[model samples]
Every structure is written in structure tokens, then in C-alpha cells.
Target: MNDTAHALGASRTLWELAERRAALTPDRPVLLQGDRSLSFGELRERAERVAAGLYGMGVRPGTVVAWQLPTRIETALLSFALVRLGAVQSPVIPFYRDHEVGFALRESRAEFFAVPGTWRGFDFAAMARRLGAKGVFEAYDGEGLPDGDPAVLPPPPAEGTSVRWIYWTSGTTSDPKGVLHTDRSLIAGGSCLAHALHLSPDDVGSIAFPYAHIGGPDYTVMLLLYGFPAVMFEQFALPDALEEYRRHGVTVAGGSTAFYSMFLAEQRRRPGGKLIPTLRLLAGGGAPKPPELYHSVVREMGVQLTHGYGMTEVPMITMGSPDDSAENLASTEGRPPEGMEIRIVDGEVRLRGEAVCQGYLDPAQTEEAFDENGFLVTGDLGRLTADGHLVLTGRLKDVIIRKGENISAKEIEDLLHRHPAVQDVAVIGLPDEERGERVCAVAEQAPGTAALTLAAVTAYLRAEGLSVHKLPEQLEVVDALPRNDTLRKVLKYKLRERYSGTVK
Candidate 1:
């Protein structure tokens, strides 16, 4: 392993690092959204202009700039611009409705906001206007921002200087908590991930995940930090993604496990159509990988599939590296990065690392997140194998205890996803009269496939050696599952709202 300590001893602030990289690789393509392409030099120049514009609007160091924009080159540039001006950025997912957006803006206490006039079939300018009228946010126009010379801007004063980014977690049981990350942490996590994925300047990354999420920001930072080219897609349509991959020769692409499943489905429909020949890695997160989906990608798409495990609190905790065995990729979230530590207490996963977030925006939540020993109690149930691989069971809070028997919803869901007819599944604990709680499986079947019944699914589970108690008591087949932007996470609470009464 390369000595991270020696390599990062002279690390600079986020902006300084980006600027130094831009100077080193001036003519390299930094971002590509559709036909638009910006070289590193061009990207740096645009970021400086945007920084000057923010400065003109009285956005100084430590000012919070809330942005609700789609995945675009402008969003990437403006984010870097905020870092250059020493202002913190809070990027809300573009799909967030008014209530969610209003809450995040109020919670973060942002002074300025940036969004595209319109993007990807949505009118963000209209959304901004509505938010402005309600006094929800102070909006700025990114399209009209002027360009300035990047060399004129001063570097950040010191390393570890605060450059905050507030991202909300998809709270399953409670309101979303704002996870506050520093520039140092973001850069460190992104650097480690870039190395693990073996990304290079020549690699073109297709980013379909929302920029409001951690994966989006991580990819953007990786591209900038390593001088890699990125093709930003506003949405994750499989056809559009395939076209982009072919057009850009994209090598590294990733999002949720569901996205990969959908991509494979599309690939099956279009036989003999291979667009991404240079594609080397397909990274997934936000949920466990279905064994079927993993095999499909390896057999059909001809790419290495990697699963990443982490939350907004401690982003990039574990990842299935590019060099990992296929069995490791299918079973574990690979190993922790060089300087990270992971342990299991009782059944909950805990982590301590430089990449971990400082704390929540709310002190009370922060206090609840960390135990007395200062390790961030991840609230995730996982165990480490003797060889040091991390096997995630499920969320500690989401485990289903039926008559004193603990059942992992993830285990059931993984088995369900392997069923030939099952496209996706989410297992949740529903209230029970006798047992404390029973498992209910909500599934979405593959298109054109016959409808699946609970009995059939149970038969498959039985054949797979699942105990009778572990099988879901009830199954609800649906057209689609509610998912976050990444499509990997199923909003179980939503399922609870709709199907809790159906559990036996």
C-alpha cells in the first residue's frame, strides 16, 4: 500500500488541491454534460468567475450557499467555486419537494442559493422563484454568472480549514438528519475511493446519481482530484446512459443496485448491442447487491461489479475494490481503506476514521450518533470475517425479531431478489399479534413475467435452505418500489405505511 501519511503530508485545502491539479493538467477534459465539455483550465476559470459572482453577492468565507440543481457541469463548477471562496455548500436533491427543500434551507441557515434556469426537462428557475417568493431561500442565477481569472483568487489559509457540506440522510424512521462534512474529509474519502477504483485521467465517469447525495459529490471530487473526465447525466435512463457510455467511452460508472439491474434489463432487450467497450467497473451502493444482478453484469455486461457500503455520516467506509475476487464482490463490502477502523459491538457496526463526518448539524443528534468511546455507532448491523472482510447484515434498528428469533431483512431480500421472477424486493418488519413482529416482503416483479405469489416465493426460499421462521409471512407484489435518487434504497417506511396491516 502507498504511504497515505507521506503522500498526504503536504495536502492542501479543497480549493488549493483542485487549483493545483488544474495547473498540473490544464488541458485535460474536466466535465462533459451532453455536447458541453470543459477542460480543467476551463473548469477552473469558470469556478473563479462563479466565486467572484458569489463574492459580489456578499457570500464570504463561512457563508452557507444552498444549491438545488440537477446533475450538470454548472453544478460541479459552482461547487468548486464555493470551496474556492471558503463558503460552505448545502446541495439539496433536485427531486426534493418544497417541504423537504424548505426544511433543509432553514436547518442549514443558508444565505445564497444557486440553480440552473432550467435543466433536464425541469424548470429550476421556476422552482427558485417559488422558493424565493415564500422566503425559503435567496436565489442566484448560475447561467448569468461572469467568468474571472482563477489565478487572481487567493488560496485557503490552512489545511483542515472548515468547508462544510450539509447533506440529509433518507431517514427511515425519523426526519432526515443533516450530515455535516468538511472539505478535508470529503477530499480524503474521494481520494481513497479513486485509488481503490483505479480511476485515471483518461477514464470517463458517467455520473447518474443526484449531486445532492454523497456518491454524486464523491464522483465529482474524484474526477477533479484525479483529472479524470466525467459525463454528467441529469437522469439515469438506461438507454441514455448506454448512449453516453458509448459516446464518451466511459470506463467507471455507478449508482444504486437497482440502477444496475435496470441497465441489465435494458441490455437484455437490446441484444448484440454493446456500447461501453472500455467499461471496467460498475460500482453500486445504497443497498445490498442481488446475487442475480451481480452475475448478470459479469455475464452479460462484461464488467466488474463492486458494492460500496457507507452512509451519509461516514461516506465510503467500505468498498469492494476492483481487484477483489468475484465471491468477495458478491458477499462483502470489501475492506476498509488504509487508515480506517471498523468493529462490531454487540450487533451494530461502529467506525473511526479521518473520513468520518465531524457531527450532525444538530448537536443532540450528534451526541446520539457517537458512543461514550467516541466511535461513531453506525446503527448498521454487520460482522467482520476472519480474513477482514465486512459482511453487512442489516440496520440494527430494522432487524425483525419474531418470537425471540432475529431475522435480517437484508438476508431475506437478497434471497428474494435471486428468484427468477423477482426484479426487486424490500423486506420489512410489520406489527404482529403473537410474535413481536413478522417479516413482510414487498416485491416488484420483472416486466412481462408472470405474477408471483407469496407461496411460490416461500417455496423458492425453502429450497434455498431458509428456515420457516425466516421466510416472510406475507408478500405484497407491487409495480415499483419507492426509492431515493440512487434507486438502491427502498423507503421501508413507505412500505410500512402501505402494507403494515397485511402482515399475518
Candidate 2:
């Protein structure tokens, strides 16, 4: 990393980092997808123009703007424009539909909503209108963004302490919590990722996940800090995206354990040759990486597999370094960065640092989310090794993370309870080869009710406005649900153990 790169953490806001990087190498490639490559210079200039456009559309500093778009240059540009204008941004994953989208707009009280207008066969604008989203506008196409002159734009934010990001965390509860993040927090999180990965200006990266994800800014900040380019995959799938990765000579890739497995599967199909010859490391986090999966990635793909542990609240808590021992990398979630303080309180991980979010948007949730010591309760079960490595054993929260997306068990359970065939239901995450965890719905059926099929349950969930990713892959009907002797709360661990050996 260069001197300016090292100073990114000290920078007040994201716009400052963008300016610093552009000053260092204006013409250098920063974001690439297909034939389009956005340079640092273009990123700055175009974002300012977009900012002006937004200003013309009535966007101003501290305006709450919600955007739901795919991984594209326009999305990043619009995001940076919001940063330049010091507007609070709430990025909704493109895959989210009316249920999640509606909840976000109403909760955040977003002044404006940006949608991709019928992207991938879904009518986002229509959905936005149905949800009564205010100031709804298309942002996918170049023509959709509001237009104005840069001279009309206000001065960029000088501080990063105020909350400028509202990231949704699908927790154990039915409703998703809005995680509050500042520019400094995001920069700190990104710095941890960039420095730990030891990425150089020459290393080419890829964003297989949605740019709206918390990892988007986490990874984008790395590109700005190190002055490297990353290929953006609007829609990522093996063999389909492999050509682009090979064409770009992507050196670093991987989104989560599922991503590593996908690459390994692709490698196994062609055993003799390298999948991507330029590939050197596969690093990611968001879900628990199986020990066997890591071994397979390293052995089969011939690339180092390093995983970490993080949530929406704290984007990058620990990251695996290229210099770490293979055993350590495979077993542990690596170590926390310099300023990150990770404390294991009664086996649950607690964190305190600049990278951690300010708290949830709900004051009650915020107060309950952190301990009196000011440490954010991660609700994840972990322990620190003698070598300072983080060993994540399990989670205290009843949330299922499949393919890097957090699915609330309680959310599905609450909705499933309304089903006519079910009396009681417990949603559990079962191990799967493709998705890290396949959502399994175990239900105690009503007496005399017919057996429920997986398809029927998923269709029912779809009708209930659940996201496709959160649909239950496996359905197991039981006569009764196991509950403890105390208050009769269903024990999910028992269900996981019982269903581990079975398939859908």
C-alpha cells in the first residue's frame, strides 16, 4: 500500500478516499465489468455529475435515499455521488422484493428510491410504486439518473462520524434491523480487508455478490486504497462467469464458503488445467466455512483459501492473511485488525472498534444490541486461539446464512405457522453442497393433515412474499416439536442434528 493508501483510515469520509485515490492515479482502472472499465478519474467525475443530477432531483446532504440495483458501474457511481453529497444511503439487495423493500422504505422513511426498472424480469419500479415508495426513479440505465451541473452540488462532507449508511441485517427476528454505519467505520472495515489480503495494484479482483451487499463497499474501498481493478459480475454463476474471470486474469476471487465450493467444483470438471490461471487466493466471509471445504479449495483449485467472520454490523472483523499458516487459515477465521478489539464474552463474540457500526436505527434495538462496556454483542459464538486467531464454533442467534445471505429462522417460522398444514415449525439450516446451508423447515403437522412437500411449502412461502433464497429447501414433518422443560422454546440444535443426515 502507498502512503496515501495507509492514510485512508484517517480520512473523514468516503469521498475523501475517492479524491485521494483519484489524485494518485486518475486514469487507473478501478471497476470493470464486460467491456466497460471505470477509472478512478471517471469514478470521481461521473459521480460528481451524478451527484449534481441527484441534486437536481432534490437530493441534498443527509437525505435518505434508498437504492435497489444489481452489481453495476451505475450503482457504484450513484453511491459515490450520494457520498459526495453527504446523503445517507440505504442499499437494498436487488433480489429483495416487495416484502423486504417495503419494510425498508417505511422504516428508513427514505425520501427517494432508486430501482433498476424491470431488471432480470422483475418490475422494480412497479414494485416500488406498489409499496408507496416516495420519489421512485430508475437508476439502472444511464438515462434514468437525475441530471444537473456539478456547480450546483454542495461541498463534500468533512466528517465521517455521522451515520451515512443504513444496512439491513436479517437477524433472528422477523424484521430486519437497520445497521447504522459511518464513512470512517466503512473505511476502517475496508482497510482491514485490503491490508490483510496484501493486495497489490496488479492484483485483479471480482465482485460476484450484489454491490448492495455490505461487502460491496468493504471490497470497493480496497480497490481505491490499493489502486487495483475488480471485475463486477452483475449475475455470477460458474462456467458462465469463468470466461470473464479468465479474460480479466482475476488474481483474487471468492465471496463466501459457497463461492469457494463453486470454484472448486468448476476446477474438478477440468482436472488437468487451471480454472483461472491468474488465480492465487480465494478469500471471503459471511458464512461458516467448513474445514473440509477449505482443504478441497486449496487442494483442488491450487489456491490459498482464507475465510473470515463478519456481520452487517461489523463488516470486516477478522480477515485471513496470505502470510498465515495453512493450518491456521483452514481452521481459524484469521485475526482482527490492529484497532479491532474482539472479546469473547461467555463464548459469544463481542467487538469494539472504529469499524463497528454506530448501532441499529431503532433506539431500543440499539440499546439492546450492545453491552454496557460499549462492545457490540455479535451474537456469534467464537473463541480466540493462543496465536490470536478467531475460531468460530457456532452462533447464538437463530439466523441461517445461505450463500452469503442471512435468512431469519424466526421470520420463516412465523410465516410458516400461518400455513394450514402446520401446527408448529422450526426453521433450521442444513448443510448443502452448493449453498453453504439449505433452509430446512421442520414442522409438527396438525392432526389428520396430509404430508407437506418441499415444493408446496416453497410455493406457499412465495405466496407469502418471501424471497426465493429464503425458501425452505427441505421439509420435514414431525408429530411433535422438541422443547425444553422450562418455557417450551423449540430447540433448533436438536432439529439440525436430526436432519443433518437427511436430504430434501
RMSD of each: 2.7, 11.1
* lDDT tens readout by residue for model 2, 61-134: 99999999989999999999999999999999887778888898999999999999888998999998789899
Candidate 2 weakest lDDT stretch, 10 residues = 482-491
Evaluate all candidate structures by whole-model CA lDDT and list the values in order: 0.77, 0.86
In Å, residue 22's CA in model 1 sits off its true spot by 1.1
Candidate 1 lDDT trough over 10 residues, lowest sum: 133-142
Clashes of each: 0, 0
Candidate 2 Cα outliers beyond 4 Å, as residue runs: 171-173, 397-504
- The alpha-carbon lDDT assigned to residue 451 of candidate 2 equals 78
Please, what's the RMSD in Å of model 2? 11.1
User: Clashing pairs in model 2?
Assistant: none
lDDT of 1 by residue, 1-504 (tens): 234322432356667666676787889997787787988887777788878766766777788888887777777777888877888888887877666777777788878776655666777667666666222222333345545554555555365546478888876666678898887788667766775776666678877888768876676667766677888887778675677778888888778787788778777887785647788788867777766678888888888888888778877888888788888888888888777888799988898887889889999999998888889998889899887889998888689999999999988988887787988889998888899898888888888887899889999999999999998888888889987665457788899888776735
TM-score of each: 0.93, 0.81
- The lDDT, on a scale of 0 to 1, for candidate 2 is 0.86
